[model samples]
Target: MPKTLIVVYADGAAHPGDIAVGLASWARCVFVTEPADHTRAMEPLLSQFGPVITTGSAAEAAARLRPYVPDGLVTYSERALRFAAEVASALELPFHDRPTVGRLTDKWLQRDALRAAGVDTVRCHRIATENDWARAVADTGLPAVLKPAHGGGSRNTFLVTDVGEGLELVRGLLSEERPGLVAGGALVLEEYLPGRDLGPFGDYVSVESIVRQGQVTDIAVTGKFPMVPPFRETGRFWPSPLEYEEEERARELARRSVEALGVRSGLTHTEIKLTPDGPRLIEVNGRLGGGINELSVRALGLNLIELAGRTALGEAVPTPDFYRGRAYFQLFHPAPRRASTLLGIEGVEEVKRNAGVTLYRPYAKAGARLPGGVQTQELDIVMGEAPDVTELATIAKEVEATLRYRFAFADEPGAAVTESSVTGAELGAL
Candidate 1:
């Protein structure tokens, strides 16, 4: 019998929709969705697959997909993870177990498991109330990391330097709107260990694998560009550059984490900081890494989404060998100011014309508003690939320097960048 693959996305509008397209090859059917703004560019390619059904709600979409009885289910966001599990259960399709999904989504729960396994990580505790907050401080001490116990892409993550900052951050989080997305309205605080920020120079290691029948397979390690965090991902590069010892430590950490979390199936994206203490497990997501995967999937010449589907569906995935080395992607944001229009992207053509640079994303439209809060993602002006870290960083700098944005309002036009503007510590964050 032909297999069916169902992909659940929050805002269905994904560019270069290869996941949907890839599943279409083997699946007997395919279904996808986005919220109100359905921006899935893969819709055009859906016809090549089986019937494509678009819906408003995952439940509604899942109901529509019921007849197909999909063999596999996969998703990107937490919302979609819940919906995918629901659809899998409704149709009895193979999927990541409920417990596994919970462990993956809930940060505190995952940390508890890691702690139990004696995993070396930053010290952390959960805060359920005012009392819990106070207790957490006493336990972990001041100048720690605070983030929603169950959140992603560094949403509401704060690095509190002192007690006052911690108190205010907690108060703001508590008072702020609760989307009720996760199970609890709790906060997770951890001892903040200062380290070299990995986003700028070092590779963001993504150890990818497909787990099936309580076993993992098809593991692939890739490198990524340094992320400007709290939810900004510039791009990724394949074949991470790691010292022999560090790479081994990361592999061991990833292996232990998968075992500790009891991840039976699906792809897991783990982010860790290589601290002096060793490979400190930052956090693990039991799914493909967004934006990062965009480059890996292309560079590695592999179909991660498809491999994940096969694992979820209890099917065998084709053997995957790491592809050509040294592929990179960059995300360009309004670094100093909100660029309203392209006043000039100086070396864009030169870079494009260069042999090694592969692809580009003109995230902002010509007349689009300048970037600030919500339009931050759109503020990214360019994305392209290079050969190695040196080339990648050089091109990234070149691309950053070339792009010029015409601001909507004329306050001072731009923020002055000083030596202090990008201090040693600040560079780590970039």
Candidate 2:
């Protein structure tokens, strides 16, 4: 029998269809989810690959997964990272090591670790309670970012332009209304890293890495389009548009940051911003960057998901040396902040008609409630391959322009009955 790998699965994560496809290239794969969220619908996608183990407690889950003799344990969700670490520990499997899990999951702790290791010296303060808001503001000051210390995918993340706005935002976070903010997770205020004017591209790029026994293998540098607002990313392209020197700086910083965080073995996504002063460290993610697998496979003939899974299985994966086939990219038009429910999406066929387009996956359909103001809450994803960055940009813009969205506004009195159609609205502003 081949080796088995236990994947800690959850909703708002790398899709099972994608995971199944990758794991099929290696050892048998089993998915384990907590009692809560959504494995039944995903089972059809994974049925051919392996079973999904859902249990009420960690101990029970460990017991269930133990019989598979899983050689590697992994999770791709920030919310599930710690839980996966615990289960990995229980199984005595190869993972990020139990002691260092906090630095991977908690934004504040992660920053502290980075700062301590001299990888990044970005100043930050933890807001433990509503009362701590002023002190946090004093520490990090205005014109900073305030976000849930344990959050990812931009949930409850905001820019604090003033002290009053900061206090009100903190209150909203500590209130019952923001359930997705991670229960009992303290907020962190950090100095905002201003970005340079990159013209057509976003100011930041991401470095995707696969690690084994603390050795880092950088696969690609992923570039971004300008964020919609506050900080909702719109899309990503492979073979970053950054200058060679800038790209090297990002990869080096990512290497240093990963080592600083004590990531023993796993896939890591380190986001770095190109600021006026120089390249600055953005947050580092312990899982595969969304869209990285697609970009890598299409543009470089690299199966990142497969490689990461193999790394988990104790395989000594090597650094990739590949010539690019083309520029591959993925884009999303996020739901506007005012959107409460999606009434319709139009022109998808037209978007498909665009040259170089490959896939159009809608995240929301008619009559579905819009997931509140987060970058992760996208209306749809448009994927394609272009001859170069210039061509990719043209296709991406055309695809985004061709589609239309009809939404019911959350704050409008008669939004329940009234549906409004618009190309899109800027996020982070209602």
lDDT scores in order: 0.62, 0.79
Clash counts for the predictions, in order: 5, 0
TM-score of each: 0.80, 0.92
Give me the displacement of residue 77 in model 1, in angstroms.
3.3
Q: Pairs clashing in candidate 2?
A: none
Give the distance in Å from residue 93's predicted Cα in candidate 2 to where it truly belongs.
1.2
Model 1: residues with Cα > 4 Å off, grouped in runs: 12-16, 32-64, 179-184, 197-200, 229-231, 322-324, 334-347, 370-378, 381-387, 406-430
Per-residue lDDT tens digits for candidate 1, residues 1-430, read 6766676655422332566555656766565655434435555565455566676565777678877766677775565676667667776766766777777877888888888888755678887765677778887887788888777645567767677668877877777665134544788898776545554554346676666776765355666555554334445556566666777678778878887888877777777666656667877777777664566556666666666666666767675564446646655453323223333233446656655556555655545544432112534434556666667767666655554444333334575522212321232232
lDDT of 2 by residue, 9-33 (tens): 8766787778877786667888888
Model 2 stretches astray by more than 4 angstroms = 40-48, 177-181, 322-325, 410-420, 424-430
